[model samples]
Target: MAGVGLVHQGRTRQYEVKVTAYVLFSCFVAAMGGLLFGYDLGITGGVTSMDPFLIKFFPSVYKQMKLEKAHENGPYCRFNNELLTLFTSSLYLAALVASLFASNTTRILGRKTSMFLGGLFFLVGALLNGFAVNVAMLIIGRLLLGFGVGYSNQSVPVYLSEMAPPNIRGALNMGFQMMITIGIFFANLINYLTAAQENGWRYSLGMGAVPALLLCIASLFLGDTPNSMIERGEYGRAKIILHKIRGTQDVDDEFQDLIDVIEVARQVAHPWRNITQPKYRPQLTLCSFIPFFQQLTGINVIMFYAPVLFQSLGFGDDASLMSAVIAVAVNVMATMVSILSVDKFGRRVLFLEGGTQMLLCQVAVGTLIALKFGVKGEGSFTKSEADLLLLFICLFVAAFAWSWGPLSWLVPSEICPLEVRSAGQSINVAVNMLFTFGIAQVFLPMLCYLKFGLFFFFAGFLVMMTIFVALLLPETKNVPIEEMNSVWNSHWFWTKFVPQEVVSDHSSSNCKPSP
Candidate 1:
């Protein structure tokens, strides 16, 4: 009875500890880097959907495409179609290269400083984009923007995961995704007000600089993550920063845990190479597939071309943009559901449930597209049919928001052992960006040729994703970072889904308790 009471009290305290003001501030600032990514989505997605934007930049192509599509005649250029794809998709290409190199950048410079450099790059890129006079300058600006995106996406998640407590880590790390949706909503709102003006895209694109500037300036006041500090042999400073982050003084045991894991790893000269070893294969596979299937779920297709999708479903241009605002707004709100429940529910449960629901939503949307719009673009739906199409798209976004969207970032950051975390996370995020580029580059062409078949293509991938999660993924909530090796080693189909006590007892047999 006494032991039970002691255990209960300890669990209560775990949930009761307050996160410090400075720590929360630093997280918000780091998450602003996510906001810049969202701003780019909002600014570019919305601006490109506008007639004035197309008319101004690619006059010849816009005119020709309009003529082909039966819209009123405009100035025509044959080059616009390919250039438009390059204009926006180049960012992801640049981002992929940056992410590939980010493993070394974070290790050498630390998370906080690396993020500051990312923000500075984004700011410069936004300035170039907003003031560009020629096609070459705009493409250069996009390359720079992608480069910063790679750095921010790779560094921020690893930083947040290390800094946050295991209990609340999901919510706090997910703050990055939340800020991203917020940035998108605001970008749409800004573009809605400006999409009709001749030079309004300049303002919409320029506004991306604000969040980048803030994140960079705020990074100056922050300290490095505990993991980074430990790697640098700054034990004393690591403890101080951990104290500041956790808002407590009794960190001796936790600090010891860090020392034990890192010391064992310190012996390996090329720790990053361990990622390919036999024991680590399951973890490496999980890290690869989670992000890979995440993009395959087609949320980016929905997010990046939201207005165009709505317009095809028969909403007017202005109405399509407004609907986009609502779609992203739903995305922000639904993510809060996962944020509140993720820790309580465990990772495997929510991911399983959410992944299944997402598959259903995609299937339903595809069926509706085939029925109402047909395989070709010849027919229009009634008001009720159009409303249902809109509802399904928003439903699909909400499903992704609560599942793969945040978890893609969360699980990768959490599952990697500290020894190779930076390198592993860089590889994972780069895969995400690479797929993002492929999706963004092909979506318009698919819509042009495949017409209604695209949603079905994404739907098939979601089916595979749902099965993948059910068969392989284990619960990661509140698992100690040091014990990830044990978790991966013992991960059978249901090892992690049982009660925590059972999992702990089972995992304990395979590895010695840390001193």
Candidate 2:
């Protein structure tokens, strides 16, 4: 905004610029946190099914049933159903609680530094989980994993939001979530490859350490976010970082803006309460509610329990696990669509369309499940119905992957002002994990009790979600970070849904344009 020429009435070579290595590399390392997050989510269903894992942790169940063969299927194999639920949801509980203190962590340590610490803990947790001998040990491992996830979840997106140029910000941030899908696919592939071995679960769980280590080491090369440096009154370092990230020596005006904004914080006397002030309240409200609905979309439930969900849909154990793999793979492919289209389509359109599609898929899944299970009874899926179920599930997976999965992380990351961004992102991510905890804790049970009806709950939530997006969600496609507040304050219908550039209203000009 300083030396950068933001206004362009026509296409130019400069306007079609490519991303720099520094931004790309920084996001790459930072997004490894997401990779580990996905790895943890995916490995659970596969690892829990591992015979050696069960025999090691639930010896009582193993001995009580007098089971001898590894492939044997019986009640003994199902001994730790509730315990597995605890294992799956424990990290989110830790994430929800840890986020309260994350603001302090990010402020003191710096964003990249916070991620480094997160990666360290993730490594610790992954190793512990890999070697766990009891339920308590496994739970402890998940707690550490949850803490690491909260730290990185809070840091990475905001870090990317700060560093990336606004023109491709949505696509870049969406790519961060795409890395998550890759992690899920990688974990599923590992599980599928090793689900047959006696002690393969250990290998599958331990593989999480590879990305953790990569993140920890790669993050060391990355600099602190320009926002974080500016917050600490490191003007010299902040200017240098801006120049390096913005790829221009003429960043003085942008640097001056940072100084001025921080001075505003000083004048406030209570900067911690700044976000709750009327001026910032709407965006804060957006930050708070977005995460609630994001989880209510039930993406986590599907990600965490795809194998189990497929099993209930009448697939055999091996087939169910394979179906979960296909589901994750589809998720990755769909996220690619988002990564390419988000900046082009604008945020508001995708949010509305994707939410509606997900709602429809939920209805279809519920209806088919009701028809198959309610009318015909359980374990009675016709081949035609089974094919349709998988089709609908993949479509649902695609719907979430392209729309909610990436946007959930992106919008909230950039929605807050820089002064409160660390805390804001942390709070939103914490809310995400909190809802994820409850939903996940309830998901398996609902599948058991509600059977086909579990989807209606998701659909019901989506109805509200779709309307909210259409009415309230702001289009932030190419808006610069400094101008996010102005975006939130813009008019309700006519201008907000359309990017400020395309709209005739000049009132939204408060935001600094990206060159």
Candidate 3:
């Protein structure tokens, strides 16, 4: 199964050099997409308060413009329930549509260009939203903005993963996911501070422009993946870029390594179709479900609906908004822990540890919420009751942030071989975003309808997720992409699990790396 033969050399000075400093510098610049994602999702929580502020603070303008009716459905507007929900969830609606096209768009435009397009949409959408006078106009801005986010969410990781070295792959790839949490933390903090001010929602919406401009500027200097360059047959160009990316003066050796990988792809005859052949079966299974099940566990539900969930706890605006900010902070901090542990502890351990921890936290939160609403009754909570409920929910969010939040993005990038990295990453991302849209859209209504029981439902799903991770996922901490086929073809998979005949060793060497 060592088709190209194992090239292991233990730890060397090469590992100490921080090869990705410049590459990750570029990564940091491109990660503006995540900031936009976090800001847009979390901004709505603060934006909802705008209707009340407009009604009370901007009364003459509110009445003159019919903005007062906008809050009729909630505190801001009771007049239009559909419009209110649309205003609240329009990003998800656009994200769902964008997910359908994002992969194809990235394929045609290439990663860097795709990200640039996303930035353009974000910029226009932010301006439109800042100036929107009606619900229809806000929806248009959100739809355009979500298109950019959907594209970024799908393309950025593949780009980063393809560029990252194997040993630190999880750390770098997870950084993209980590930026998302940081974006949320930053967004929520901005909103919390601004929520009581006049026209604060406009400021919050317009804040998206900050990251959009940075992304647009950053894309200009960024390098496309070596895989992309290889696929396009720009080998000499890929070599030069890889030198700059790795920050090495030695281009000759690196060029040969890339060429070696590309040659493997050439022998496979059809790299994409080989994913279904017995040898590539492990990668196929990991690619499809690693991401889909990540969503099935219901992380997005919490992210998209944290405010509503806090409101259900009988907290007032100040308490709920403050708690949401804390939750975002917890998410950011916990992900940092994962970043520190992922390389040392390995992927399988992180998932097992994080998933099980998350399951327990969900169960406790579920029980607490159920007991609070069902046993204590919903009219008003005792001081202690409110505190306990808040503590439990915070713990639940912390658990998710540490475990699924970053690792879900990290594992998929590492598991697929170089031959199928981009396409496989695209598939995984498409599944994640598609489910993210569906789940984010329904979570609020499901909670409104299901009430406290929603926690228990999610808790059950969390357990299922924990079990699947324990039973199926391989530890990929040090496994190089070229060696993945060995594990994929093992008898453990061949006899006991997947029953397909493994692709012979002779054929494995032929699956070339790009360009």
Candidate 4:
């Protein structure tokens, strides 16, 4: 279909572009931001479990840990200190606040600028965390890291979606999540290698700087997307970059579509307010709900506390960390499955299948834990039982990696129109951060009280979200970004909310440009 133009229903000729090396390079650079985020996610749990790190920053927790080893406390209550949890959750609280401001920054300064600034902030934060000698310094460093994550998470997915060819957009956008899984695997591997060394926690936390530096230097050389260029009124530069990325000069049809969309976007003085209008209800709902549901999958709590959870399950320190490494390795491999088949299999199929797989795994794991350690948490798992538990947990992680992990970021970024794209993505990031913060803060306490019931709670949410996807989410495979509104206009439930005339006018204007 590329290199040949075809007129559809008397509208302007439609042109498809080939993926060029420049586009791949730009996407790879942008996805480095996710590596920074995922490293932080994986490193914090391992660092918290280290004896030296706990003795230095959380002496109370270290005392509790020692007492639990002597069988003086319940296994569920060993690491339930509020201050210890704060060390991990504070970053997400900061990220939630920063994401709101990042929306405007991504819109005004462009996606590349936001990414560059994010790298600088992450660089500083990583250094501060590496050298921190007290709890205050460590929390401050975490806050800075949160600001960096907020900015990058808001922009990178949008940049990837805008730059990728329509046919491969889902696969390209998933590069961000693929990087996240790889980062988690690397962090867990590093933690396993460094756990026996002196000041090993510092090494695990500080390695985040490597990806930050890479993203910073790479973003400077990469050109902004054509959509972003047009949004900023850089018409000449937009066409030049479009031709270069598309690998052809016959980009007039796609170029004109971008211009027409920007003209409509320019008329709206307040994008935030515009997103709240009734017609945008579907977009707003997806932005708010998808991230919320993704967190309820319990993936973060597992990723954030894998080492601690394994320790509480009666694994020795070295064994616990090794289990975490294996689990994260499974996560990385499963995410590769998503990148290879997302566009081919489509989003909804992955969502439904993965949700069912995760649901079964969660219920099985819960039953195993409940049978091994009853309500009082006084029992321990046998060797065979512990291995079976690990197997189920790995299965759950693999299911999520191929489904919700990547789609959560991809769908929200691609669904929103240009006018509300930044704001929609900001909302997505904000909701994600908010839920992540809440879960991080409460997980330890919930573990203390709820015991084995927590997984069932998450499984209940998984059921509801799977049904939501099947009924509400339409197929978006191979749809051009500029024509996404047509998806809502045709969907059974969403069509009533979206005005047909508005959709028609927008499509016609994009297809048949003005004289």
**The candidate that achieves the highest TM-score relative to the unseen native structure:** 4
Per-model TM against the reference: 0.90, 0.88, 0.84, 0.96
Model 3 Cα displacement at 172 (Å)? 1.3
Candidates' C-alpha lDDT:
0.76, 0.76, 0.66, 0.89
**Candidate 1's TM-score:** 0.90
lDDT of 1 by residue, 1-66 (tens): 011000111121112234788678878888888898888866777777777678777786557645
Q: Which candidate tops lDDT?
A: 4
* Two-way TM-score contest, 1 vs 2, winner: 1
What does the lDDT come to for candidate 3?
A: 0.66
lDDT of 1: 0.76
Looking at model 4, residue 6 earns an lDDT score of 26
The count of residue-pair clashes in candidate 4 stands at 0
> What is the lDDT for 328 in model 1?
91
Report the C-alpha lDDT of model 2 over 384-445, residue by residue, as the tens digit: 78888888889988988889889989998887766677667877888898998888777765
Error of 3 at 333 (Å): 0.7
Off by over 4 Å in 1: 1-18, 69-80, 493-515
For model 2, state the Cα shift of residue 256 in Å. 1.6
- Quote the lDDT for 208 in model 1: 82
* lDDT winner, 1 or 2: 1
lDDT for model 4: 0.89
- C-alpha lDDT (0 to 100) for residue 438 of candidate 2: 86
Q: Give the clashing pairs for model 2.
A: none
